[model samples]
Target: MLSYELFFKEGLYNAEFIKKFTIDFDLLESQVEPYTPEYASMITGLSADDIVTTAREYATSSGSMIAYTLGITEHHCGVNNVFDIANLALLTGNIGKQGTGIMPLRGQNNVQGAGDMGCLPNQLAGGMSLANDEFRARYEKEWGVKLNPYPDDTQTRTFDRLEMGELKALYVIGENPLLADVHMNHTKTLFEKLDLLIVQDIFLTETAQMADVVLPARSWGEVDGTYTNTDRRIQRVRKAVEPHPNTKEDWEILCDLATLMGYPMHYHNSKEIWNEVRKLAWEIYGGITYDRLEEEYSIHYPCPDENHPGTFILHERFHKQNPDIKKSRFVPVDYTEPLELPDPEYPFMLTTGRRYESYNTHSQTRFYAAGIKVKQTEETIDIHPEDACSLGIQDGEMVQVTSRRGELLVKVKITEQVVPGLVFMSFHWSETPTNVLTLNEYDPISGTAEYKACAVAITKVS
Candidate 1:
């Protein structure tokens, strides 16, 4: 493992802070052996020489950055994986500076924005802790209402609540959980049990098909809003076309629904809603206004006031002086095996991801003629040539992939991108329904399903 010290603006950190954090770091790292290049090679299947060379370069570099995507989060130990990444940054003193620190590529556009707008079940806008008394008081003052100290269940737990008849209704938007969530059959059963299932989207997705009420919402081109990209750049999304005659913006729909339910929501337009967000989430998005978005094209959050230029690099001092902040603490984590391991029966590891031709679940991209032409019209499993030969499977031939949960017959694309004992498939086509074969085991903390690794057996389709 790499060893380094904490830095502040080219100078060493305060002696007291460094000593305390060093003890904490040492205690955490003591739980496991140092990850030497040989150990990494054994675990990751990379060459030892390459691993050593890469480690040397990474450690000796003036500034280094690490970025990852769903591949890191879509695991049974997703939260721990993130902690380990953070630990690496801390060890190397690569944080709180430009061209350094960690970056997690969002799975979709506006995913960061959604969280910033308080879409999570546990936290309020700007990542204010719902459980914190001070955070609640601040939001209550801004919202003019008492806030719920205890947050509700996460999306993963909704199915459990529905199964127990505790959750009677669900309001889904922009996501097709039926085709996207792990254990597709189980998700479908839970949807069937819901007393009321409401879906709002631009298209009738598989989940919408089962909804008791489907509300058509305006598409991106028809709505004016802001989308925060993976790097925290909040960009304006102006209406480029009129919404469909029968549809309206999602905000308008929600406002109407809230008013009808006797909880009146008064917002003249999207801008009004954004202004309220700015008032409440002043810590992160205070400086990002609709007017600024139009003028600058985009602005990063933690923008404190109107005159303050939007911050590009975050954690200038690593949240040292901000209100309601605490000194950073070292979180040590150890590696764990995947929840589901390949066995003699299921001898191959199956991993799912996106293709360039399609976005998540093909909500919109499938209909694009050019995208369809660029990729295979249907779902195909990517297999190494050696694995296909052993299974008597030919290139472009049909193969049956079976897990304990379900099975699918898909065309095979023999390639070297995947190792011999592993297969990769894009979960983009409804026809293939890849989620059916994915394990339902999820990270205990993040509740993100283990879509990156699962055990499945493959055979040539007769």
Candidate 2:
């Protein structure tokens, strides 16, 4: 994570390298590994002794940088998933190696940039903590705007207020919240009550269809910009096509909107925007330019100059005392049961995710030379083999999935990809619309909805 400004607290981050509690081998009755058996057997229904033995075996295994994406996160206990991985990294002390580190993959190409720019609820632009007066002062000095000292930059509340009809207007850009977000009905209900809804997109999306104003926008191909990938790669995107005459690139689009909103937004080109982002938040992202990026296809950000070789592995000296002092936090976890466990009425816990073929949602890929058809939509309720046999259902058979939020008819894909107690489906579904079945409950800290866990019942249909 390239941050132009923010820094981490030290002692908060440490491996069990330093002794804390007295270790009693006699008292060490239980052994646990992360994700696997040593997994929290108490809460996760895993075998404690078995996982401990297996974790011993797992520790001996070696490989390249272990990178995990949404497969690890997007869970009821997503934070634990990260905590465990970080612990595993600290155990082996996999810092400052060429092909080592706990690589928690990101959801988007520009997620790092967004993180740097402080799109999060808690931080300010340039990675400054919203609570820190010093960080706020730095931004105030740079922008010359009397920014609010209070720490209240909550997008979760903005969406929540929109749902409650407390917020009259909502502007969304390059994102399809309808299919992309969990609890589809709740979002629709809230958006329905809104006096005005604005959606800016390269293509007409399901969310755009419901918007009061759908502003056409240029795609990455028709735009010149820089996208920082999960690996902190700073790459350039050139304009391969014209900005569709009517639609403009994101930078121009933002500037025009800001100008109309009485903010003096000005930028001649994409390079200028990058320069501004660098200027505002120089600690993490310093003296870097398109000309420097053009020298190579991509290089990691924080390179700071044309002369610097990129840093792929971070935190060798940084994580230690009196150095960079940026040790990754090791948060020991206590597992909690998912909100909705399997019951008689709702006999299965439903979880949602993305498929390799589809991107965010179906709208982009649904229409082909043939047409958009329900059968073309590849969403299926992933049922365990035992569950399918017990429910008297076969693979490819249609099933009625009912959840607390709503219900939908979806095909059943009987497989052992997931555990027996849980069922899986992709949020990418539009016709089946998996989000319709998801609950509105979200992570209190991240405001990330618990899209992964909801009570669902599957009955053989059609």
Candidate 3:
């Protein structure tokens, strides 16, 4: 906004108040290591005084739009980052507007749909808040499946159980979790322990290498479907060409699997499945149909009737009422240090992130620099100029970093963006796997790992 502080102009809220935080910034209480002004130091390398001043300006601003990608989500504090984002949005009242919202730039084409359709470990379709029973009952009635009453929200999510001899069968769809998730050694070990590993992908991915059954799947080019994008656009996509031999659409594959599993999912085609989805879906998809889509050419959901137009923006006025009003609680979140901190044994905090050159874990492509094959793909750590000079290192110098789990040799990129005693790396390569060196500990609330903070010993290798 034109105002000095964006959040204040828009009446948004921020959690930063009176706290000592950290020297580098710990966001702690006067004595507590957690939830202080030093918390600013946790995210930025500024001094405590500087952090307090900057945070005051930011938190008290009129309106602010939080922008984040894999860098925010791939860490152990990933859930906290998401929660923090939401908290900021709610606190500042920046949501329900044109210029401000917690924007999670989506990775793939259909992730939002998958999340909206309830493809997460928790919740049902339409991004229905999992704790709601009315939503659960609706799904049970629509699909005739006995729904689990409790939400399966786990921040430290792991299929590692499947590899650690805990879980049995696996039914993977388009996801290449083996390459996509952290801890390659652990993930591969988990894949090895599975009794059944079924992979369905347009191309045979690295994860598919260990699968017992590989089902050839149709690509987006050969499918007619509706994809939801980051901007909440429900756009239509038509089939452009025929899929290769023995390949079929994911809907057909799912229907077949359902039939085999003793649930008769008898759908003729993609259109048939979409029809059923629209009929049972209550909120946004109440009025959408393949017939209507064909006639109107394209339409967003929440139209409710043939005459009604699709929705573009979510926050207008009365329609944006808070449905979570029963025992709605505004939490006063105090900041906390990451679960793992660097000590004498490990003198640095090694944080892992992604690169803008390509997507996260997109390791099998030619353009990607796998294991130093390409310059952009090489493993590099972000450190401050002071820390780099103290360690007798320069930019692009090979360094050995050892964490509790494992180690990797990488080049260094010195920057002052991060606080001293903290370091960062990218988890995008297959050969130079970052997860091997990352702690598996997760947030108790979200099951997301504390990938942002891991104690490690960093030394110049050459």
Q: Let me know the TM-score candidate 3 reaches against the reference structure.
A: 0.77
Candidates, ranked, TM-score: 1, 2, 3
Candidate rank order under lDDT? 1, 2, 3
- Which pairs clash inside model 1? none
lDDT (tens digit, per residue) of candidate 3 on 1-462: 011123333332333321111021122112222434455554555566665565456565665677777666655556666766665555445555666677788667667777777777666666666567877777788788878877653413446455456668787888777766555567777788878889998767777888999988887889888887776666678899988878998888887888998999887666666666666564677677767777776665566555567765555441244444332123334445677777899989887766666566663343534465444746678898889989999998898888877888888999897668888877776667787787766656656555667788988885
Give the local distance difference test score of model 3: 0.66
| TM-score, candidate number 2 | 0.84
Candidate 3, poorest ten consecutive residues by summed lDDT: 17-26
- Per-prediction TM-score to the true structure, in the order listed: 0.92, 0.84, 0.77
Q: Please report how far candidate 2 places residue 393 from its true position, in Å.
A: 1.8
Off by over 4 Å in 3: 1-43, 47-62, 70-81, 128-145, 148-166, 290-302, 315-328, 367-377, 382-385, 394-397, 413-420
Best by TM-score: 1
